[model samples]
Target: MFDAVRNNRKIVQIFLVLICLPFALWGVDSYVHGGGAGEDPASVGDTKITAQQFQQAWRQQQDRLRQALGANYKSEEANTPEARLAVLNSLIDQRLLALEANQARLGVSDEALRNFIARIPSLQENGAFSMARYEAALSAQGLSQPQFEAQLRQDLTLQQLVGAVGESSLVAKSSTDAIMRIEAEERQASEFRFPAAQYSAQASVDAAAVKKFYDENARLFQTPERARAEYVVLSQEALLAQVKVADEEVKAWYDGHKDRYQSAEERRASHILLLDKDKDPAKTKAAAEAILREVQAQPAKFAEIARSRSQDPGSANKGGDLGFFARGMMVKAFDDAAFKLKDGEVSGVVQSEFGYHIIKLTGIHPGKQRSLEEVRPEIVAELKRQASAKRFAEAAEAFSNMVYEQADSLKPAAERFGLKVETSGWLAKAPKPQDLPAYGVLGEPKLLKALFADDAVKNKRNTDAIEIAPNTLVAARVVEYQPAAARPLTEVSAQIESGLKLREAAAQAKKAGEAKLAELQKGGEDKLAWSATKTFSRLQPLPAPPAAARAVFQAPVGKLPAFVGVTLDNGDYALYRVAKVSQPEAIDEARRKAVEREYSTLLAQEDFAAYLAALRARTKVEINQKALEASDR
Candidate 1:
């Protein structure tokens, strides 16, 4: 089917039109019919949006979001009601555009479609179209070349309507100039903040008020529901503690796999390196050749020459010694030259990416097989791990069934498996996910949820065995359950008093700041120390809360030193004195052009939306709300 679609463009184009008859892309059959045979997710005019089409679009949207968020993507972030509605609305818009294009008899030329595909940045390499890259991109999306082109043609036809509507949009030069001037304007201001702490001494809370607040919001003082549990864990590590490997078994395994104990040969070498510092490769090569000749003449003084002349600071300090390393550890040219030289023998000038080098072979550690005594501990450990893993695999199914069939206590399973019945401290009904790590196996989300189930908490029944990790199972039962209760009034009174004082202090600070602002606005005389005046703009604002910065820009500038007040996010009141306002003297032509482009694009989008709205009004659309919501599940 894929080969045939790739071979015939006309046949693929026809196939594309026929395949989307009952989907978001409208066909002649859909344009004449109201809906498909079965109930559909939505319908724009007479075209039905099929469930399969909705699912495909939904999955595509999911992929786009995952790619955008990268590692930050969360499973629960998708499939929200708002996300589903956005997808459905997108499908409706596509259906509307397809219907309009069909009615207008719009079409894209074959050459035009080919040009669009070739110009795609992903399909190009070295600034030229690459057939291999284009084919791989299509293959990644499970699309054939002809099928992709057919779809591209339909999209290009719809773009014609978009272009027609956008061409009708007109942006005014006056509006662009006014917005540009506003953006370029700057304001100077001085700030004075009234800290909430200054009013703390004056805030006196009455005993009656504190009691009333405590009574009204008692839930805040209640203790959470928690339980203590007795649990048993069946894991490979737990089984490994019981596994003992015999000396005979270790000997047999080591003898059978002696090749695994062979250690690769390692070489230790020293080198003097010279790098091309002045972008003159010939000068560096000459310097390296001179050093090589010096070392060759005085063989015993190689270390002395290397220390004085080598440019590699790391190895030069230690007489140009590079510690022992196995093959393939260093650059290819350097590694080959170092290994080819005999002990204490120096090589001629060798060139690598770094520049030039002279290498000396110092020591060689040949490959060798280990004796039985040297690797006995390692062999014993490997044998025990293998035995434990096999034992755990066989016991896991029986463990799961035993816990469920017993269903009363973890004792039966623990005794049968020679495991300990561990006890937990108080655990909340729903502990924070991050805090679960301290509980070990009990921290696993699935196991924790199971342990806190109502049946386990109230009835004191063992939870069904849950796989907490690979080859690890856990079953727990509540030994002591604590119902939700309230802490005593006396125990929480001090906390309530501290909170009440802070709230009252913030209120008093705001009241005082407002009075000072009112007096200043009335042109009254007052002395308030202000921070150094700073000039700021919408593009570059003062280092303060957004509300404080906004107060500076929003103050009236008719009079010098106008005052404005705002309560900040941290519960402090701030007042600003607007000293001066100014705008740029000359217009920047490049900046003007950029702003004009942005303003024109906004106008074009508005015009296109209006045209789409006019078309939607003339068409009949129906949506299945129930089916749309059900699809999320």
Candidate 2:
């Protein structure tokens, strides 16, 4: 029903990467337990939706919203009952789909899964699948190969079920025709606007009116609660600068992993392909052999002959060049033949799935390993990175323990890690974008909750070390705190007066416009000037205001001319006179087909929604409200 279903293959590939891969990016804690140890958040039929799964889904959604909304995103908004229920419903839907898929015995084969992984552009190097890059990427996300592959296979299976439901939709021609008729119907209209600004000079406001407004809206004048803190950060980058690697360690690592630096052999080859589609196999092979002999006899004419004889459309115009390729990149038979030939040498006829090929080897690059001197800088950097990682792991535990054991001040932890205690500017519970660096761990939800705990703020104790991001620990102590308070009425009187005056002006304008409309309907004339007539339809928008356009289309068509009035967004009023209504001559074939496709997609979406509703009704869904609320905390 979504465009993702219509353009199924490409969209599914993108969805697989974005959805499945990010599960691994959630870190090692995500994989510790597949389900929570306590009560379930929800249950679908016989299966339970675990608390851990719901929590992970909530966090992933929060991260996605933060990225999309940027500075406008607030993490606390996700802690509400409605947001938690939405997440629970999504988990229930996924469980239902997975149950159906399992019952149907639908699956993805290993070969198909491998091919899909190979095609992912992120795992490739130089347009070819790189095993080293693939392993490194998975390791960086903290996922094993089997874990990623299993998730990918499950997603592909679910896509098969979704595609089956979406592709079966049908659209009737009569329905399409009826829709087009209404969409193509056009109206011509004239408008007269009553501007609110014209009445502003007549509006009067006194001190009593301003005082009443300010009293009723006192909440708008309150200042938010703020706090300032001193904190320290222990991150991997900070530790990396302190780590030092010796020359002997670098040499030892290089010697143990010498095979990692060896480059694979590559070959550059061109071929003349003879088609076996209509001709006999023997004849095709004989022709290929003849071309090979001619090429061997006259090497310069190989390109000329290939251009006329090759059957591959992609390479025929380019003299049948296949470019340079490493082993396992091409078919086994072709790779074997090409690698066996020396530079500037020709080979006999070779048979493949496509046709018979007369191969010519133009270049060869032998496999070689770099000397330690040539790669000394790279080895040293890798050794230092490895050493830094080990040190960070050891220091992270110490940092957490010290902060907890010595809860009064950050000075002990900072002295232990050699990190300076830094002071931050005023920070609110909901920090702005510019305050993120100063707030540090206070910007994170869990740490912010802890920092605002009754004891931490009142007693001036330090928070427990929190992992704000991967491998980054932070802890803070409150240095100053201020409670929320309301500002004095004198400071906000001017704003209140200005707001009340504008509202009074808009009300006066609306009253005058209504009186004028009534007089015009009773055959009286006014001095207001009307704009030129413009045509509009449901599909083709006019330059008039949206309220005016909507009124023009909704007015009765039987009456030759009709009048309608509406309030515009600028606090102005508009009266529209509908003059003429016209129907389209005919619907073009191309546009009709497009409309039919769109209509069918809408029908399919409704069908799918109904199907899901039916499935929900048939199953017994039990939700633990208390457990759901506890999980949010």
TM-scores vs. true structure, each candidate: 0.61, 0.68
Off by over 4 Å in 1: 1-38, 65-74, 121-140, 166-168, 222-452, 459-486, 605-612
Model 1 agreement with the true structure over 14-122: per-residue lDDT tens digits: 3223223323233434444665644578887767887777887888778777788774454455668887887887777777877888888888888888788878987
Candidate lDDT values, in order = 0.79, 0.77
Q: Backbone clash tally for model 1?
A: 0
lDDT per residue for candidate 2 within 1-633, as digits (tens), equals 134444433433433332242332222222222554357898777767787677778887778778887765666655689988877786676666666777788889999998999789988643445576688889996778988887777777877877677667788899888888888888888888778888888988999998887788888898878778888888887888887878888889899999888899999988888778676998888888888888888898888888988876656777878788998766667778998999988888888655788888888888999999898889888887888788889999999999989999999999988888988788787666676776655677777777777878899899889887678888888899987788888888888877777788888888988888788666576566778988887776466877777778787767766667788888888887778898889888887877777777666666666766787898887888989989877
Best by lDDT: 1
Q: How many backbone clashes does candidate 2 have?
A: 0
* Superposed Cα deviation of residue 446, candidate 2 (Å): 2.7
- Tell me the TM-score of model 1: 0.61
Model 2's TM-score against the true structure: 0.68
